[model samples]
Target: MKVDAISNDTAYYFLRQLGLERFNVKNLNAGHCAKARSWESKKAKGAWSMSRYAEPDENGEVEGVDGQNNNVAYLSRSNGNSPTEQLKKIGLSANKFTFLRMMRGSTLRALVPYLNKEQLLLAMRLFPKMLLVRLIGSLPKDMLLKMILHTIPLKKFLALFKAKVLFSIVANKRLNVREMVNGLEHLPREELQRLMTNITGSDTTQLNKPELLGMFRELDKLQLMNGLRKMGQEHFLEFVYQVTKKDPQLLMALPRGELMKVVNSMPKPTLVELFNLLPKSQLEQFVSMLPYKALLVALYQIDNKTMESLLVNQFPDLIAALAGDGLEAA
Candidate 1:
């Protein structure tokens, strides 16, 4: 009974809790899944062996296989001889730490051939999500697209790529969109649609001129505020007018500091309306990073009661300044 639904931990847990039925990825239905363990798999045809988890320590430290060494003694006494016995079975000549480090340096391309069908199915679970997404964003479009095509655990890869955390990181320029988009293109139409929805909050089919124009216009505004060629106040206002014609959410692509800069420089009415469009949680986070002048300017927009509530409810330290004649007094 190969079960597709119980192919992950969350699915297994939820189903078993709801019914008295335990499930696992390897054998959701016993005798159904044909996957085998790594040890039982045939040796890799290539020189790069995934089963051969060993590397020499550069520091020249050697650990004895006998139970005399403290670590080895503990392993022998507690976990029994399974790990060391397994190492001997595989002819690996390295300590546990060295073996772990080798796994750390292992690449999917080089290691895939050595994985049994079971390991291949579960392989995506091991990726360091944030680190890999950041790295993927930096890769040239061609390279990133290729990796996405060959990657295991397509579900996790898609989930990580479509995560809001990845979106924010990309917005702050920690990840490049062009490379991200190129990689996204390799996804099937369904996945590609989901990614666009995560990013734009609209169906891919619904994205017409407004979304694209809004995004490009906002990027241009960001470039002017912090790019090579700067625009004057009048031109910025004109651009802001164009941006206001669309959605303010797109402007969120700007770095936090740059977002504040844009707010500080905008006309009073525009600034007030712009902040209104911001989510309260995100706005409060940005407020915490605001410079004294920008924060002071923002204070003038809200009422004394709202400001007092903010001081009392969230920013207690600002209460001293709010109560006093000026910030310098606090």
Candidate 2:
């Protein structure tokens, strides 16, 4: 349901078609981030509410429900007295807009939870599988899960879950190998074949080291940890080497003991390369995360030339002192 596959430009284009002539993608993204911060603050305080179609005044303020000066005239004109009646009025009034377009707008996203089963079915029928993905992604997490469980059938639900896992694999989310392999089982045979072709190539040769690393780069630290945890000692070293070649940061996701174990298993040259690749800040963090004994063992195992290079690069003053240079002199 995560809609990373649908670009901001696509959303912008759709909004423009749906009568938002002045829709700005940059403003939308920035505004969403700002709203997310505000929502987090409100959430921490245990107070937050959303409405599907509240009209704000010139000052961008809506009267509270408890206000003495409620919009009595508007309420009266909306037809039924019950909350369901008001919701039906809103839904019918906004009938021209498809569920896809509604999902794209922050205000209209609130309307989804109020949709009747028949209305929900109609919307799903109108939407393609991918746009349904967007709708699933657009809803708040709790609402999305609840709605999916209640509304979507078992087979389609599994298919969507697989799609979500696939999207995460290819996108920045970089979910680990285990989840990816498990999710693949849910996909149709044809779709699975297409996924394989897309991952390797049309020619279907085995993925080379560089190609594998390229795919690994998409994975985050936790994902790397999960994937690496299952690897054999030799394969772990090779995979970690390839991962570090793409990004040493991915290794940071491992727990302290696991990291130390891998560090112990790694060759001196690869260890040196990893240290060389990390920035001073990250190097400090990496050192701080591991036990001093593990670090000492690693230091003892390094060859003199590699140790000298590491010392000169990371601690010039210490190197200077070792060579009998005074503290104030090089």
Candidate 3:
């Protein structure tokens, strides 16, 4: 759009939509095309003017300019709609390219928060997946990931983000699991699981015990704690439980802080079983990292002699209370 032609209904509205800096319309009004100007009634109370000049078309619709006529109806509608919706609707064949190609980053980012699942899918279908992926890749990861996770269903998002599936499979075939994971930051979560399952020779049909354990160790190598954290504590615990239930020995692979968070979030039964599976050295590492309650529960599952030795080594004073009764009271 010409610098001088930005108007409240079109260019200015889009800038406002994306929260971009827009030229003041007063100064830029010099270039407002009269045809574009006539779409809106001068005295309309809102950003868009709805006027009927009544030079009806053959179809009896009020006449308007051919090329730059923007339907400002969306300007007044609700549901947190983008102004571009109207532009997209009427500008169908004409300026559709302009809306997508010339849109500012802020505008694109702004489009994310309000587009419902249906609209987002519609928009996704409008563009090629790679182009959409490139556009989405430009967004801040935290913001974009949250947008995909909370509002857009990950299954649907992955369906739209088919490259994540395609690229992940390609990368896994070419690179080691860690290499593939570390190399591609934008791979989808489900595809990451598929890759994990593929690498470990686990059945893709269902996640079995050995497969869960394999996923655990492999994802740990990928340093997936931060990503899991964003996936939510509930899902995080379920993920850990799957790993720990089948092969808790791999619990040692988790970073101390991440493991503590996982174990502490789990119920006592699961925490007990997971801790019981830890070997002596890893158990010691886990003991120091967990809080008093989780640590105490873990100790209850260890052999008396080993528990005593652990308590003596880690907390000498607690040894005295546990000396007589094998930790029934201490």
Candidate 2 stretches greater than 4 Å from native = 1-140, 157-174, 185-198, 201-330
Give the per-residue lDDT of model 1 (tens digit) for 121-187.
2322222333224423443443333333333233332232323322343344433334333332333
Go through the candidates in order and give the clash count of each: 0, 0, 0
Question: What lDDT does candidate 2 reach at residue 234?
Answer: 37
Please write out the lDDT profile of model 2 over residues 66-137, one tens digit for every residue: 111233422343332432333333231121111121121222222233333332332232233343344334
- Name the top lDDT candidate: 2
Structure candidate 1, residue pairs in collision: none
Candidate 3 weakest lDDT stretch, 10 residues: 321-330
Which 10 consecutive residues of model 2 have the lowest summed lDDT? 321-330
Q: Model 2 reaches what TM-score against the true structure?
A: 0.18
TM-score of each: 0.17, 0.18, 0.18
Q: Candidate 1's error at 300, in angstroms?
A: 62
Tens digits of per-residue lDDT for model 3 on 1-330? 112113335534333322333324332232223323322233133332334222333422223212122323222232233433332233222222122222222222322433333322322232323333343344343433443334434333333322322233222223334432333334335644555444555656565445544555556443443344244333333433443334323323333332233223334333233223223443333233322212222222223344333222332221221121121210
| C-alpha lDDT (0 to 100) for residue 268 of candidate 3 | 37
Distance from true position, residue 176, model 1, in Å?
Answer: 25
> What is the Å distance of residue 270 in model 3 from its true position?
42
